[model samples]
Target: MAAPRWDLGPAREPLGLIRALQGFFSVFAFATLGGFQGSVSFHLSCAGSPNISVSAPFAYPFRLNLATFTPSLTALCNRTWARDVHLVGDFSSSAQFFVVVAVFSFLYSLGALLLYLGYLHLYRGAGGKLPLGDFLATAAFSFLWLVASSAWAKALTDVKASVAAPLPYCHPPAVICSRDTTTPMGTLNVSVVFGFLNLILWLGSSWFVFKETNFHTPPAPSTPSTM
Candidate 1:
């Protein structure tokens, strides 16, 4: 008969804790997503041209590696960002995918923070609790992030291993191009760490919701006596 109303009930202890942690994660997510410097770098060198280097912050998804052309091979390499050092791990699609995952992670974590704050300030007085919809959304996003982060770590490791050999393109005939990447483990480690943390947070929040739902239900109204 009535549209489902927003939940407004006393907050559970665990829910409060979960919201606090969500806020913390949002801040760290911002740092790890774009603020932190990426360790991976690219170095490209061609015959007669001096070596060029491009370093990027953590490839949360992917970073474009660009090298400048020297005066010697201005005609060949050119002085633009188009010349990519083609290597196993120079600019892989998997790297870009990882960045995508990280972006979504940042957005969702930030959303969690806003939702928590909004509920606390605007809804708490009206007995508002974290709605099932919000909880479900968090659960879904967290699960996907967990999987994406795991895959990103694995993919990065594979790319690192595959790029061990030198390329023929980096020679006299074509163009001498090489890739020298910095530590790939930093991004992987951060992804895995937050991935697991988010998973646990979602699970804990779910369990708390479940407990509250079952234990604090309102009693059904009694039937009226017959005249």
Candidate 2:
């Protein structure tokens, strides 16, 4: 008797959803458009008779203008200062956070695209059965992305705090005071939001794969009749 063959079924909705999400992530990661791109803006102001203000805008993955404080506030107050006080914070911390997000997203997106090709008949035209190796890879990478996204979100919060927190020189009794500082956090916030969205989608895909593989079994081959 001939051995049994694995039966393939129609593609599941969850799998298609996962493929769609993967494509979306790939675009965002490569283009760095929509939520992936962000900028930080800081304004320095000294409180005295006439308020003096200077604004600096910083783009992510490029330059980060944390906090620029004019050191020679006394000179400015006395009209003896030739240049504006310069204050800056180490932007490496936040830059690193964004870099990690971009790199991982790109990698995950590429993996997902390859898997999609396999499923769509573009690559190997693999059947509907979810392979064990693929499942394991998906689960592992999904978890990694989840954790990274969470970290990215937390890092954004930290960046916001750092932007708001007064620097050492700006302590009370200091001539140069940080009158007001604000950062448009929409870009980073959107990235963090999408991260959670991707995490949920990945978990759902994993669960679907697990159920399909565990509950459904291919029919066994029937014995051949003797002529």
Candidate 3:
């Protein structure tokens, strides 16, 4: 029945800071990984034709197996080239999983921050249910970040290998193919770093939120009896 009171005190506390960081880093984690667009180049040389360069472009949800690149020349050095050359690997599952977790973490952290800043009284008055829910959500996010980041890291490794490896059609004796260049994945690497950082922040904040719950209260000590 009372008017809501705004309090800035919680924003200065450790839990609030952690939530802010979780939201901040989550933006970078998903943005970098989701907005990523890069390509792998290959140089082709045949017995007598001029050297040809081709690049296969790949983007978010990185299904390399579907990426296609056409060489400049249809027929070169007495050999015909496929119009649509595809790269290898299907890493969409792991990449998407990582992005999804980052996105959700960002949304949850933002909402929690709002509640802490504008609805502190209501939160405190929730009879321990709010804190218990917060603790559980924090723990769940910590675990999710771990799984998503680890899976994405491994998938990224395979993606790099697939891009760098020579193409199957180039194995013929008449043609030779070699890697030319690979777009830098520095942003993606940073995304992984942010993911783990979020994991650490969420894991650390769990303890603080747990303390607010009744479960973390110490049992009352019984008075010692003396005769």
What is the TM-score (0 to 1) of candidate 3?
A: 0.89
User: Ten residues in a row with the worst lDDT in model 1?
Assistant: 64-73
Ranked candidates (TM-score, high to low):
3, 2, 1
TM-score list, all predictions? 0.55, 0.60, 0.89
Query: What digit string (tens of lDDT, one per residue) describes model 1 on residues 1-227?
Result: 32334333322356656755754664454356444344444466644567666443434343333322222233344443334333333434554444555456556555654544444444233232444445566667667656655675676566555434443334453355656765545644665576567667766766654443313554456899999
Model 1 alpha-carbon drift over 4 Å, by segment: 1-12, 33-60, 63-84, 89-130, 162-165, 169-184, 214-227
TM-score of 1: 0.55
Off by over 4 Å in 2: 1-12, 25-50, 55-57, 61-130, 170-181, 211-227
The per-candidate count of clashes, in order, stands at 9, 4, 0
Give lDDT for model 3. 0.85
Scored by lDDT, model 2 comes in at 0.51
Task: Sort the predicted structures by lDDT, highest score first.
Answer: 3, 2, 1
Query: On a 0 to 100 scale, what is the lDDT of residue 217 in model 2?
Result: 42
Model 3 regions more than 4 Å off: 1-3, 72-83, 171-173, 218-227
lDDT of 2 by residue, 65-135 (tens): 44344444446544434554333445454445544654665565566555544443422223424444556
Strongest candidate by lDDT:
3
**Deviation in Å, model 1, residue 220 alpha carbon:** 4.1
